[model samples]
Each structure stands twice: as C-alpha cells, then as structure tokens.
Target: MTALPETTAKKLGLVIDLDTCVGCHACVVACKGWNTENYGAPLSDQSAYGAAPKGTFLNRVHAYEVQPDTGAAQTVHFPKSCLHCEDAPCVTVCPTGASYKRVEDGIVLVNEDDCIGCGLCAWACPYGARELDKAAGVMKKCTLCVDRIYNENLPEEDREPACVRTCPAGARHFGDLGDPGSAVSQLVIEREGVDLMPELGTKPVNKYLPPRPKDVLDEIDVLSPFLAPVAEESKGLAGWLDRVLEKI
Candidate 1:
C-alpha cells in the first residue's frame, strides 16, 4: 500500500456531491479545456466526418434511470473519472512504469515521457479511467492538474483543478482526503459519501455523495377549454379563464 507523505503538503482530491450535480457537462468541458492545452497531449477526435467517429475524453457522465424495489423513479447521472486510488490497479498493471503514484503526494499520474503505449493499464482499470493517447502512443488519464495545483506562479486560490473551479452548482470540492479535519473530509463524513464499485477494493481516494430521495411525477393530465360543461360558464369569463390558465 502506498502511504501518504508526511513532509509534503497533504494529498488533495475531489469530493463530488451527487445530490447537487445536475448532470451538466460543464465540468467535462472544463477538464478537456485544461488538459488538452496543458497536459502532455490533447484528447483527440478521429474520422470527424466518418460514420464511426470516436474521441477520447478523461471524464464522462453516465445517466442511469434507477427503479428501486420500492417503486421509486430516480434518474442518477454519475460523472465517471479517475479515482486516483491508493491501491490503483492501473499503476500495478503497467509493465513500463509509465503509470505511477507520486511519492510527494498520493496523486496517481502517468509519466508520458516514459510510456510505451501498452494497453495493460486501461484493461486493469475497472472504472474505465485510462484511455489511449493515439497521438502520443501512450495511455492518458486525469492528472488532477498537477502542473497547475503546485505552480507557485499561479494565485493560491487558482491552484485547484479546473473542473472543481468551474462547477456551477458547487457540487465539486478539492482538498486533502488524508487530513481528517479538511473540509472535503468533513463533508464526506456528514453526507455519508460512497465510493464507486467499492467491492473491487481499489481504495479510491475520491468520494461521491448519493442524491437525496425525491418525489416523482405521479400522473399527466390534459385539459381542454372546449371540453368544459356549458353550466360552468355561469362562473363568469374571469373564473373560467383562471381554470383554463391553471390547467394549461
């Protein structure tokens, strides 16, 4: 097991609030924007005008319509990305030492300069976090913006990853998961946050809080002014107009 560094600043991570996440792709776009420009290589799209066009993205949002045994209607939009696990399977499976966990902090990163374009890391990751960088002939995944977060030239507040900074609903938070007193740690405790696919025992550092229970629409009705009874006309045009407005 990789241990957290004591001398360096705490290892930070994201704690996503699933309850507040509206499934907006803002975070995804923000991640692509930052990584494509700053990371080793840009995520690419191939055969733009072809029928089998495809692209690579570090983060993706999955929309699931969940039907519970209790007959509740819920739509769960899970935003999937690299978990930066302590026992990262991707790192262990890499034959070329391209995938590694930082000793300075616990952040998992790929050494693009040393990569050999092996697909072992992608296959080992159950979360589907690793994607091949065809242009660079290596695997690519989220860096958590290592270059930006630790840069002294950047404003202290602007050091966090772009996704967390661009989240409009405030559903994303970045901080040290190692420190129990950190805001992210406290939020996880308070919200009973959960790990994705915990049965795999990857020990993911990032956490996701489940959405709260909500009432679903029970029925749909259509009202027509032409279908109303003639006797109801005595209620006056104003009252009839109000009912029509309400139904509409």
Candidate 2:
C-alpha cells in the first residue's frame, strides 16, 4: 500500500482587500459562530438580557471616517484582530509558553492550558490584537480557524478560514503567504498593501489593502455654469476692446 505524502509546512496568512470590503460584518459573525462551537471555550456575553451587555470576540470590525480636505469623507471599515506576525511580540513577552507561533503554519496561538492570564502579551502587541477572555481568564485572538482549514473530511474548496469563507464582499483571502506564487502574495504585490503600525516592526503576516480614492464633488462644482461667467457678457465690441487693452 502506498502512503500519502506528509503535509508540508506552510505560512498561512490573510490578505484583506479594504477597497472591496463593504463593512457588512459577516466575517465577524461567522468567526464568532465557528469559534464558539470549535474552540476550548465559547465567547460568552454578560448581561445578555439586561443593560450593559458585552461579549468576547476573536475578531471585530471597526469603522473609521477618513477625511481629506481636498476630497469627500471616506468611511473605512476595517477588521481588527491578531495579525499572526512573523516576529510576534506576543510570543516573546509571554513568560509562560502559552503564547506561541506555529512553526508548521506561522499561526500565532495561545495554549489555553498553559495560560496564566498575565496580560503581558496584550501589552506587547502594538496593533491591539490580543484581548483578555474574562470568562476563560485567558488571552484570546484570531486563530485563522486552524481546526477547520486542515480537516480531512472537508472538501478542498471548503478548507479555508471562516472569515475568508463568509466575507460577503470577497474582501478576505487566505493562503500560504511564504509561497511567492500564492494568491495572497500576488494580491499584496499588486495592491501595494500596507501593514498597520509598521513602525512597531512586528512584521505582521496579515496585509491590508487601502481603499481607492473616490471622485471629488468640489471639482465638479467648479465647472458648473452657476460658478462660471456668462459667455455673452464677455463678448462683442466692449469685450474686444477690453481684451485688446488688457494684452498690453
């Protein structure tokens, strides 16, 4: 009997197309639903039926208004979570072995069993990726759906992170970033995607492509007839005489 080839180690990562994302929050909801069922502890909500309700989520979408004086206000909706950085500060800061980067796939994961909830890893991260899971008393963040992507029972097409699968606007893409031929790598090259807070030098594996600039309304207004002088007023002998004298 022939044995199957061993699965090669891959640097799995995500490339988010900010230009294409519609801020639908489908990816956030999908992540919550999947992680709740698969992970060690569910993301629970406190005071669900009362006021001051809150819950823990591995991923969250944030909306920001970016205004330029020369253009219209741009509404940018970006998802925030663990970047699974190449030089992950979270891993180095952990006194316990709880926070770690997977050598096989480059996913930053917290071993819940070993976590003491020191919150050091949270502070080490510049992107605000890590969050304390109050119910579990451990730090939690995006896992890239590690359990689902490698499942043998799942079809090849279905083997992807929940966020990528559920993104309604096709904003999310998942693949081996280390491979130059990979789709995610190609996208990063084509879009000139930027890392958030690059000055921190976490060397984040995740990439965010900036939104394309929209047309300015003020430019259109400048060409309207209401703003321009009437052609007839500048014509005839008076206009000709004025034009001739002005040339001097």
Candidate 3:
C-alpha cells in the first residue's frame, strides 16, 4: 500500500440530493455506460442472459422506507459511490499498491495492471465503493469520471460525469469540494450536507444533502368550510366526493 500524500491539492467530489432523487436509476445507467466505455476496464456481468444476473457497477441507487415520528411514510432514494476519502482505507489496504488516491485531484483509482484480485480494498471500504470485477480479475470503483471531466475535446457543458449530465431530476452534482467558493461546497454549506459513516474516519470527500423535512398538511383544511356541510348532506362516500367536487 502506498502512503497517501500529506495533502491533496483539490478535493474533487460529488454532492447528492436525496430529496430530489426519484429512484429511477438514471444515474446508475449513465455511470455504467460511461465508465465501462471510457475507463480502461470493461465492467462485466455474470449470467446476464439468465434469469438471475449481476454486473460490476461504479455507482448504484438504493431506496429505503423512512417514517418520521409524526408524518406520512417517505421513500428516500440514495445514490452511493466512491467518496475519494482523504485517508482512504481502501487505498491503504491494497497490498499491490494498485489502489491510490491522486494527490492533485483526490480521485481514488485502481491500477488494473497491479491488482491481483485480492479484494482487500473492497473489504476495507466501509461504503462498499470498491467492487471486484470477477470476470476481469481486478477491483473496480468510481473515478469521478476523470476522463470526461478533463477531456478538452468535449464541449464545456458535456465535461461533467455522465451521471450528473443524465440525471433528469438534477439530483447529482460534481465539483471541487476543496475550494470553499466552489458551487458544490456552497451547496454543502447551504443544505447542511453530511458525510456517510463519518465515524469510520475514512474522511470521504463526497457529501449528501439530507432530505428537507416536509410540512404536515393533513390538519390544514385546503377546501372551503361549505364543503364540510355538503359532505354531511351526502348519503355515501361517493356522494360526499361528488359534493366536494361540485363545491370545487
């Protein structure tokens, strides 16, 4: 394992908004498509033609049912990927020195040539960001779309990661977290963004914007009070609904 640089020049990372992510897997698809093609390794799937299939992906979205103390149940769509931590456990555990964090930009990367499929990095990672491409016999992870972000051949607007570019809800964002004036950093400050598993001490660079609390509206009457009297006059539920519609 190679020692991390004393200080990284730039902490380039992502800020994901849980409130806006719709669990549509748009980011997942776009991530897989871009990384598999742009990155050196080809992310392979096992038994893809069969009923049960699994594939290596750099990014994935998960949905969870969250119920607060006093409100309706809500679904939180969470997008997970490599955080490019300052003291990345995954990079430190690589015996072959294949896993390393870039001192210039803070992007954690795996050198496929040096990887021996030991799976230590994957196990060391608390965020499950490192994945083994069983078919390719090496570890894989998100590189923060390093290729596209630095490619001068592409249009300025298309320079961002595919996941950020393809998100229909605009839930994903990419920028330098090291610079306080950066847009992603301002978002973290404004939204009170948090790190995932901060206790583990990996010092993940990526941040997540927590879901904004929703205001309860059940107790508030949205319709006119005259509709209430009309509801009492109705004979059944359908009749009450009809009366409410008529009142509207």
Candidate 4:
C-alpha cells in the first residue's frame, strides 16, 4: 500500500467557476488530446464508431439542471477530474504502490510501470477520476498536465494545463492553491468556493465556485414592446391597404 506525503510543498490544483462554464466540452477535448499525445500511452477507444463507444479520458463534463427555490431552473455545466486529495484513498488502497502523491506539488499520479491493470484505485476514488487504458493495460488519470507545466521549451503563457488553456469561457484556473495569496485562492475566497464532498474528508485541492442566482423576469415579457402592433388604427395609404385587404 502507498502512503501520502505528510505535507506537500505546494497544493497545485484547479478552481472551476460554475457560473461561467458553458458546457462547450472544449476542455474535455483538450485534455484528451494533450494526455494522449504528451503524457503517457495513447488513450484507447473501443468500437468508437459503433454502439456503446468507450474511450479513456482524463477529464469529463457533466451538466445538471438545478432548480432554485424561487426562479426558473438553470443548467450547470460541471467539469470534473482528479482533485489530488491530501488524503487520497486511491493511493493508500493501491496494493502495488503504483499510485502515489508527489511531495513537491501534491499531484496524485499512477506509475504505469508498477501498475498491474487492477481496478482497485478506480473503485477507491470517490470522484471516479481514474480510468484503465485497455490497450496499454495500465491505469490512466489526470496529472494536471505535469509535463507541460514544467516544460521549459513551452512559452510562459502555455505552462498551464491544456484544459485550462483551451477553456473558451475561462471557467478553469490552475495554480498553487496552497498559497492563500494566489489568484486562484483569492477567487475561491471571494466566490465562496466549495469542495466536492467535505464530509468524506478527502481534502481535495480543487474548488468549485457556486453558480450565482439568476434574475427572474417571469412577471413580464420584456420583448412585448417590440412585438406590439405598430398601429391599431391605420390612416391614409395604410388605411387604404387595410381596407382593401379586409374587402378581399
């Protein structure tokens, strides 16, 4: 079994803004592409064009229609991945010590060489972040774009995770969450960011900003003015045309 680090040098994680996510799935595609090409073994898909297509992906988005106490329901697009919990059950439950957390940045990663293609880590993960690559016979998961972030060859602006970089709506943010003064941490404090499941005691580094309350305009149709008739009673040329139509 693997043991978690007593304290990581930094808690590198993501801050997801639920209010801004547009359910575009761009982040999902970016993550898939980056992980497949740069990180580890290529992501495998079985019967992709056929029924019940299955593929391994590090990130995924789920949309939910939430009904507020008083207004119309709203759709919330939730993008989820590995939270890199401080007390990760998946790491501790790994019989082969393949899953481990980095002490430098607190990123939970699976050593594919040590992995025996066992689904124990997946079962232990509460967020369902880990997936088994059928073709490589190894466990795959989100490494928070570890390679890209640390690569000196890439541009300074491109150092973040691919998902964060490709998000059109700017819903995703990546930084050292351990620092209270970091931009991501400040955003969390301002937006009252919440953990996935606090009761589970996972201490996940990732935080989600709750969707803001939307304005309810059910009392009146604001477009009624433009939709109203321009003239209830016509005169002159308009009156002649109306009369002719009525006569016909």
Taking all chains together, each candidate's TM-score versus the true structure is 0.81, 0.82, 0.88, 0.87
Model 2: colliding residue pairs: none
Q: Residue by residue across 134-209, what tens digits does model 4's lDDT show? A: 8999999999999989999999999999999999999999999999999999999999999998989999999999
Regions of model 1 farther than 4 Å from truth? 1-9, 215-248
Error of 4 at 227 (Å): 15
Give one digit per residue, the lDDT tens place, for model 3 in 162-197: 899999998999999999999999999999999899
Q: TM-score for candidate 4, please give it.
A: 0.87
Q: CA shift at 174, candidate 1, in angstroms?
A: 0.7
Candidate number of the best lDDT: 4
lDDT of 4: 0.93
Model 2 whole-model lDDT (C-alpha atoms): 0.83
Give the Cα error of residue 94 in candidate 2, in Å.
Answer: 1.0
How would you encode candidate 1's per-residue C-alpha lDDT over 1-248 as one tens digit per residue?
22323343555688988888889989899988889888787887787579998777888888888788887668877888888887788887777777888866778888888888878889988999989976677788989889889889889988998888888999899989989999999999999998888999988889998888786786755665557676654367988888899899
Candidate with best TM-score: 3
RMSD of 3: 5.7
Say which prediction, candidate 2 or candidate 3, comes out ahead on TM-score. Answer: 3
